[model samples]
Target: MSDIPLEHVHREPDSDTGNAVFVLHGRGADEQDLLPVADRLPGDRHIVSFRAPDRLRGGYTWYDLDLSGGGLESSQPDPDGFRRSLDMVAESIDAAVDAYDLDSDSLGLLGFSQGAITSLSLVLERPDTFAWVAAHHGYLAESHADRSPDGIEGKPVFVAAGAADQIIPASRSEAAAEGMREAGADVTFGTFEGGHGIGPDELEAVQAFVEEHD
Candidate 1:
């Protein structure tokens, strides 16, 4: 576990409901980046947006990526950094729950790109931590494939990817969906018509998915 403190933005619902959603930003983005999307979610839930721990350029990253080789095969994710971020996220969630008197059973997670990778990792590593998860334009890290054999049989998962995403190919997204299914999660996977970013249609689908499980 890491000793680093997590930076976050918390939005309380109008009615002060105990439910909460943890929103994670993509690479080069901060905690505030996903606040709008969290606001648009279909619920009276509290929103907590967390910042990545690692500083990269002017923004932040959950883990360092090594693309020294050629293709995705040569790319390497920093395992140590990833683990630290995971710990930080866990700590943040606990703190949020306590501070807001939130319902642990109603907790959900949403992430984009690098944030999505970390979110999925958290769900896989701690299957009972989240009620539902939405991973956008992300993949399961190769390093975490052998952690545990325990399956998330009843967990609900939504995965959205762009068919023309240049940064993360559709193949990676498909493989991620397959992996989640193999882990026994009830997975809802979809591919959009655009590039490496989220669109209105994708957000609508995610809203519906979350509502279904909420």
Candidate 2:
């Protein structure tokens, strides 16, 4: 869909494993930001992180945010840019699978902040693309989040957030978990003691979740 593919950084596993995880970093972050997180995962997973389509600050953005109406927690994603990134992300996953000879059925999704929002929407929009998902500190998109009728039945989703988070409050993540559950996802919502970032306990829980699915 996009003429110029999203810029990305990819790491291959030591073995010939076809399993892979598509990582998406937060707003104002690059593809490289989440590569280190992948090291905490298993050695057999191929980690690929994609740069957002637009440049913002010193990093990248999946879409513009509208905070005019309320606080940061109430900010909504600009629909046009939001939907555009969704398409690009889908394309990128397809390209990655073909380019690296990865297994489509063994795909996983990992994302944070705006990237988390994108990942959440994708699993709803294209449920079959990923086997599991991990979304940290983000909420469901406010617009154009169309879940297919059949829905993501039995899909495994891990949503972690800070209980004291002001950026995208814990309540928002709770609602996200509810949303995914309503769509038949096997959701595991993890809450850490801190605010707006993952903690060691949260990381361990996330790692365990991934390990279970992998």
Candidate 3:
């Protein structure tokens, strides 16, 4: 769908373990933003982090935002733009698996904020693509919430929300967790004391989820 190529940073594990993890960065962040977290996660899994295609301000964004009314909300995402980016991410994952000769069965996704939104949407849209998912400080976009939940049944999902998050309120995050649970996913949901950001506790939980699922 999208003709634009996906740009990324790939890190190979010390040994070939036939597994891989893909990292998706928050809004206004680049591919390198999540590289450190990839290193912290357990296992010898190839790590790949993709840069969002759209440039905004000094950084990149997965989708445009509507900061109207003094709150953060996704503008009606351009359908073509969203589809193109999603297609690129899917293609990139296929390419990575093939290039690294990695096991497709063990692939995982970790994303924060807008990146987390994309991760959840992708996994919901194409549930078979990821073995597990960790979405931090993100909620399911309203546009993508009507899909059948059957595809994600039994899938492992981790949702970390910031209790004081002004950008994405806890109520929204809780709703996202409920949505995942209703989809029959084995969801692990937690909330930190901070606001709209990840911390050490969140990281530890993510590591545990990855270890348990992978």
Best by TM-score: 2
C-alpha local distance difference test of each model: 0.85, 0.87, 0.83
In model 3, which regions exceed 4 Å deviation?
Answer: 1-4, 66-70, 73-78
Q: Distance from true position, residue 130, model 2, in Å?
A: 0.6
Which whole-number lDDT from 0 to 100 does residue 65 have in model 1?
80
TM-score of 3: 0.91
Cα misplacement distance, residue 44 of candidate 3 (Å): 1.2
User: Model 2, range 10-93, lDDT digits (tens) per residue?
Assistant: 888888899999999999999988877767875487888999999999999999998876867789888889989999999889
For model 1 the TM-score comes to 0.93
Off by over 4 Å in 2: 1-4, 144-148
* Number of backbone clashes in candidate 3: 0
- Candidate 2 residue pairs that clash: none
Ranking by TM-score: 2, 1, 3
Record all residue pairs in model 1 with backbone atoms less than 3 Å apart, i.e. clashing.
Answer: none
Q: Candidates sorted by lDDT, descending order?
A: 2, 1, 3
Candidate 2 colliding pairs, count: 0
**Weakest 10 consecutive residues, lDDT, candidate 1?**
68-77
Report each candidate's C-alpha RMSD, comma-separated, in the order given: 2.5, 2.0, 2.6
The TM-score values for the models, in the order shown, are 0.93, 0.94, 0.91
